[model samples]
Target: MSTDCTTSSASTLTRRSLVLGIPLVAAACVSPGGGPAGPWRAMSYAEMYGPVVEGQYRIPAIDTTTINPAFLRSEVSWTGPEAAGTIVVDPKARYAYLVQPGGKALRYGVGVGREGFAWNGNARVGAKREWPKWFPPKEMIEREPRLEPYREGMDPGIQNPLGARALYLYEGQKDTLYRLHGTNEPKSIGTAASSGCIRLFNQDIIDLYARVEMNAPVVVRA
Candidate 1:
């Protein structure tokens, strides 16, 4: 995707600024639960929402009541070419699926790239970071001079646009500048509002981060 910042503020950069790297993995029949063997039980709204304390950082709980129900995390049937453990993003549907065994996927509502910023292709989760920093791309700074201060990078925290977790996507050895990351703007879920990256709720991202393995495949579909 081309350089574009979703917001004109200095605090965030266009989704094109996010990039990642990792090797590919073969397809496997892994359970959707991603844990002990058993029927996958869905997490209740209360169970999924709350303050998440990771190390010194405390991620505040999301007010699920304000969010659309369709955007909530849940498991759904999936029939895609990707293997289990692969991350499949359906931009038009505004949903992301973490493929699981038995024709199932852990589906999560997401905020996709805005019209002109959309991109699609295969990539891999090259790296992962917690409370990742934010750096406005050079082109973004040129367009919005107010972002000049963040040209170097912004410190990680709740205010950061990347939110609590980030899974960088790469194609072969090249950085695609796209990400499957947590978003500070939870309200943006189920909408096409980002510059190019895919956004998930903080709690959902944290859960996904724990289940996803390094070098997992990611397929973004337009």
Candidate 2:
């Protein structure tokens, strides 16, 4: 099971709240560089809602082996000095860069934490997991009682929150609950969704999962 979905429709912050009765998977990602910037337009409902059953999404099987090539996108940055081999996640733009040896970098779209959940500073990828199991902390379980039933482990399936892969965040040797994971809810990308975890597209996660090794540095910023 994933996170709670108890919020009334009124509490939803989506731009397409007007279009009810259908699962949100049909919405589309707002195309950038448009005439006038307004509320985001989802590229399709599949971006968030996926395939719907009677009313809910019938999520598809997650292909852990194949990375979706569509997610390799780039956004602008201040273009600062490359401190040798380092990865930088520009919080404002919601993009992360894997610094290359020359002046180039491979950029990826990311979903950051909203407002109070935003984090910064230096850390590293302590370890990695393919179809990693999720265990919410004690406080999270307390706040959302529905999470209690999933304490043991969630199977690596389409509905799994970790998506295709997970890069565990850490400081020194301590694990920060925050993770860099792929999301079934692709619309959540380029926006904040969770307390502090960074979400990515399934294809993007699988790509990074293959490139990144243990103890890879990760720098987040405001």
Candidate 3:
């Protein structure tokens, strides 16, 4: 899918103002005599991926042992023009970021569309759903006959591909039929293995669902 400050009290305050941009811009905002601001504190993998009862379902905990530590959720310095609250997906890098103020972002590892199934450009979060129904596209059903059964739709559950949450992407009035959703397959994070949508860890999606608002802009890089 798609998707500053100065110095002095007046000048100093401006200097310390958090600006979102490439590393160079962020570097210039360094505090006077102070190094970079204190590092962002993120939750431990255990807590971040722990099993929790969400709604009517109990989401299972992720086994971080098999996942790369780098792919885990953390605060990162972002170098992009998107404003705060935007969702940016880097398919090649297998990462999805929620842009934060002050040249920083909340980064999460993601599984993107595989090969030819990948898509790019901009879209907006048109709708949000929890434990959403899964309706396999006709094309997908043709590719995997087994999915034909879901052509009508699949009820929400732990085994559902949409996992704990889904954010439907749209282009103005048109539905892109692409989503930023959760998956039970933690191992898929950081890989190009989806049909076209972006997938995150179940827990991560739950967290993202809560933070994102309606009509949030999304950018999926080529």
Candidate 4:
């Protein structure tokens, strides 16, 4: 597999940005008084109609950066214990945990299934790609032939399905037929719905995608 961002195989994708030890840097571009310009209004109608995640996520923007902490779940914490493993996704709490030694975990607030359709159990991130070319599985093409054209590939840009990054999931060295990836849907950041893949704000995934390895174990919980 290529460590570089380019798609090695024809089946995968290449990220537009080469992630090479990039540090998270933020300057106080906003004037000191105006109550920080963040958590803007939801863009899509579905998300606007639906409930908001409050401070969990924010609408995507170029200049604005939405880097919220994971421990801000507030009243959404679960009764059950947190999973102990390499990775964990507490969908109910809308947080994903990357377990590490010394009892610390790298946690990130995530957008889960809308109406109880989230994926669970153990899986591995077999491959990682940037701006992945979305080849809708055969089942989708069968139902909607219009998508057949995408079987080839799509380049990186605003319209790309995989957004800024993608982390491919596999179950025991096999493709799980699912992906934990990013989406351009800014409104869908907090709530899940009719979207096909698990969507995250592009910046969030760019952070998450760089943290995990190619074969890291993932455990999604209810």
Candidate 5:
């Protein structure tokens, strides 16, 4: 039940299309010190998809070949201000980094908000959920009346826009109305197509969801 961006209306760009349309740069292509480039070549489908569980909802395997190698998950050197375990999102670079202890980070490609939809600031992972239900915001519904049917909420499943996991961001006591979540569209990994939320591949989100803890610091840079 995954929604296809192709079928979306041209007059009103859906959030899904926004998240998928941003161009991914090859900033990390050379790798540090001219080392072996493109870590994705060394990764296998099994490693990218992991094992399946019976009865549990599972994300469909993505054809890694269809994705840009730059968007593939890999460890990269991070010299940012965030501390270990912090999630730093560089919307301009279309990359998200989970800072590690040794000047390194688990880097994953992300789809961020478009020009006007984008925001920069600090927030905390106030909540996390797996296969979370989706409640289209009033603004989204107004732009795309077709989503009116889902005003109540869409149930958790593979077809759901939230994909396999969602990490809610909060600024102190108030919800930022933003999220770091999985997308059904893997091709969106290196784009600026989302309305405002940050999106990751489903497999990447699962990996991120496991390492991120409640109240983890998240810094989104414009």
Candidate 6:
């Protein structure tokens, strides 16, 4: 069965409420040209985060200027224990890695859960959904009754907390009640802000969703 993390759909809860501290520069050594200074195609920031249209929703182009340049997607060296095709999330570093074959990984900036809400462990991608609906967890509804109205489920839209795609997490046969989903909040990237789920930008999530298959290994680190 599908479960919910701590995120809510209440409009009253502004971005300011979600952010706790200044933006963390996890990729301090990354170059200013939109990604790590390496042998890349030299794609401009505009092309990487341009607007996209899926089904009927038109995802707005991200304003790269406003966000930390290091948070943008890039291919970087990988020395983790996991093999290729594994998904590894470093919540403390606000980054997610999709391990590739050549001792490299495609890294994306992420927004993670706040202090007490963060969780980490081994899990797998149990399922994938495009334009997925969102169901507020019981606890979140209790904290903000406004979300109760969406108890049934929130429709898929650009503003939906789940954004364009969602990868449901599971451990063996049990749902972990966590996800690696997309968010419309570009500013949330590189910050500890979400309730429990790992969030990527819409463009990044769409890219990740297409590459990740069902049952892909996932390791979320504390």
Q: Top model by TM-score, which number?
A: 6
Clashes of each: 4, 15, 16, 0, 7, 0
- What ranges in model 3 sit over 4 Å off? 1-42
Q: lDDT (0-100) at residue 162 of candidate 1?
A: 83
- The C-alpha RMSD of each candidate to the native structure, in angstroms, is 9.9, 12.0, 12.1, 12.0, 10.3, 9.6
lDDT of every model, 2 decimals: 0.71, 0.58, 0.71, 0.49, 0.71, 0.75
Q: Across residues 1-222, which tens digit of lDDT does each residue of candidate 3 receive?
A: 111000012211111122111122232122211112323233345555656664468777787888997787767787899998899999988899888777878788898888778889899999999888888877777667877677788788878888878999989978888899988677888988888889988877776776787999999898
Colliding pairs, model 6: none
Q: Candidate order by TM-score, highest to lowest? A: 6, 1, 3, 5, 2, 4
Can you give the TM-score per candidate against the true fold? 0.82, 0.66, 0.81, 0.60, 0.79, 0.82
Q: State, as a TM-score between 0 and 1, how close model 6 is to the true structure.
A: 0.82
lDDT of 2 by residue, 96-198 (tens): 7766544555567787877776778788988898776776776777887787777776666557777767888788998777788877776666776666777
Q: To one decimal, what is the Cα RMSD in angstroms of model 1 from the true structure?
A: 9.9
User: Hey, what RMSD does candidate 4 come out at?
Assistant: 12.0
Q: Could you give candidate 5's per-residue lDDT for residues 51-155 as a string of tens digits?
A: 323145755667777878888777788788788879999999999988877687878899988767787899999999988899888887777888889889888
Per-residue error at 93 for model 6, in Å?
Answer: 0.8
Q: How far is 26's C-alpha from truth in model 3 (Å)?
A: 28
lDDT of 1 by residue, 1-222 (tens): 122233222322212111110112213212235421224343445445445665666666677889887778777787887888899999999999888887878888899998877889999999899788877677667876877888888788777878888898889987777888888778888998887889898777776776688889999986
Q: What value does the lDDT take at residue 198 in candidate 6? A: 94
Rate residue 36 of model 2 by lDDT: 12
TM-score of candidate 3 to 2 decimals:
0.81
